[model samples]
Target: MYRWPFISVVLIIAILLVLAFVLNLSIGEVWLNPFQLFFSENLQSAILISEFRLPRAIAAVLVGSALSLSGLMMQTLFRNPIAGPYVLGISSGSVLGVSLVILGGSIFSAEFLSSNSAIIIAALVGGLAMMFILLMVLKIIKDIMTLLIVGMMFGAFATSVSSILQYFSPGFQVKAFVLWTFGSLSKVDYPQIYWMISFIVLALFFVVLSLKGLNLLTLGTSQLEQFGIKTKRLHFIILLATALLTSSVTAFCGPIGFIGVIVPHISKKILKTSNHWRLMPVSMMIGAFIMLVSEMLTHLPGSGMVLPINSVTAFIGIPFILWILFKPLKNEI
Candidate 1:
């Protein structure tokens, strides 16, 4: 499988992430000289690095990993080359939960502190609840395409409900909800990064350990059963993993999309095999790189207007999905 090349690609992606991290620490509306970030007395630069750049950079990398891994697992589970984090409406559910907090938060402004934890807790509840519903639907439907459609419809329903809520919301509350839907890596601060990092690390450790099972599944259901694989148990495990990672990103970074969907396709094409061992880590690196690239696009210096990270990601993810749909191979990874 040319393991050396796979490792080389990951190393190169990691190096690129380091470079982006340094560059991200430097650039801002008040440009800090790259050299001056370290070599000069620019306290403003130091503060920017500590406050804005560092958190955003860390969030970019973490969100990217989470989304990418979730997508990879979904594709493997659904046997759909294009399945991503969005396929299950998990992120939309999280969005709905956030909307509840934003719109209704001011109703208790005298006790806003109580609402902060409520917001995140509500998001987790929404996401896991949706996941549970999807699992039950999958059991009944027994058709992959049907399950996919059900997820889409469920997400649409959540969005509709959220829209109705926003209609009656205060102006600032609506505005806050809108911005949160668009997705932003810069919004995550230092206080939250520790939990985000710790959770993602632990989740990914289990996911990576499942690589062997994932690899075996690529041989098809008959082989997997022959190998004593409990199809339903594994199914739930992967879905739970997907839910955990997706919920984490949606909770913290507001549903950063595309990394989970398209990076796995790119990984499959690059690795030229369905083995999870090769695809998993590579997908993680590619996801992070794509995120760094999109983050730069969002803050492009000359544009005079910042673009949403979703804008750039949709551009990348949509094309890959369309390509997969319009022209497919008998064995799609």
Candidate 2:
């Protein structure tokens, strides 16, 4: 009975994913008929479908999958329903990195560092630096609450630095920074997509290996110890994997949110299972579907103006968050 329901949910999500993919490709600035996408003689339409929409769709899938998985891992690690990638401030670290390059370049008149490649590098470096610091602190701290507090402090520090840079930045630099923070799937190109996918795959490999540990962890640290699971070591591995996933998405897509926090809950609610083996794959699918929907909403069928992907996600995510807050207390996973 349980297996059938889980399989049904997977099948439903898979179908929606396919439909979303088709709609994403077909409903851009110029709508292309599904049948004619491959056979269309219009060169401009073909280019739009192949060159532009395809990359954005691919980005949505990868970013959604990475953020959802990362958020699930975090929620599991902290045993908190609300914990998410952005909640830990890793995304802020990336923002600070990008701000330093964009705003700093404008302030110092350094044209060379303002390029897209430089910005990506700076973001990656800043995110990894923050991850390293958090991992180091995790070694000294055993309490999950204390670790969360430390992560918040890191985020606050990064935000303060970003604020200072923004205050000193020129109009154009500030504008650029603001736009990046709004988040986007359209910014990813083919080369960046390749790297993002590679990083996600590697991080997910680590996650798959640790599934049994994750399942044991849900039973509490004592139970984990009883099972011969090295809780500290496993926590390190989970955090490291999460950092890799979160930082890569933030670096490439500029800190997309809500999908991470929302998708896992949606998956758990649907699957009614705490087993990581089941939860992980379901969360990935639901996350990707939500992102595709968000991407579709960003460009309404007839709307000429493109909305920020972040705004659409906020609309979808905030309601769920409020529900979680006000609902009667229950086991989250």
Report the number of the highest-TM-score candidate. Answer: 2
List RMSD in Å for every model shown: 3.1, 1.7
Looking at model 1, how many pairs of residues clash? 0
Total clashing pairs for each candidate: 0, 0
- Native-referenced Cα lDDT, model 2: 0.87
Clashes of 2: 0
Query: What TM value does model 2 have?
Result: 0.96
What is the per-residue lDDT of model 1 for residues 1-333, given as tens digits with 9 covering 90 to 100? 354576677778789878877776666566667766777576766777888887988888888878998999888877777788878899888878887777756554533622545666777778878888988986776445577788899999999988887887778778777887788877678777887777687777668667777887776662455787766566667777788888877887777777798888888777787878878888888888788778877876954476788888888778877887787854442
Candidate 1: the clashing residue pairs are none
Model 1 CA RMSD to the hidden true structure, in angstroms? 3.1
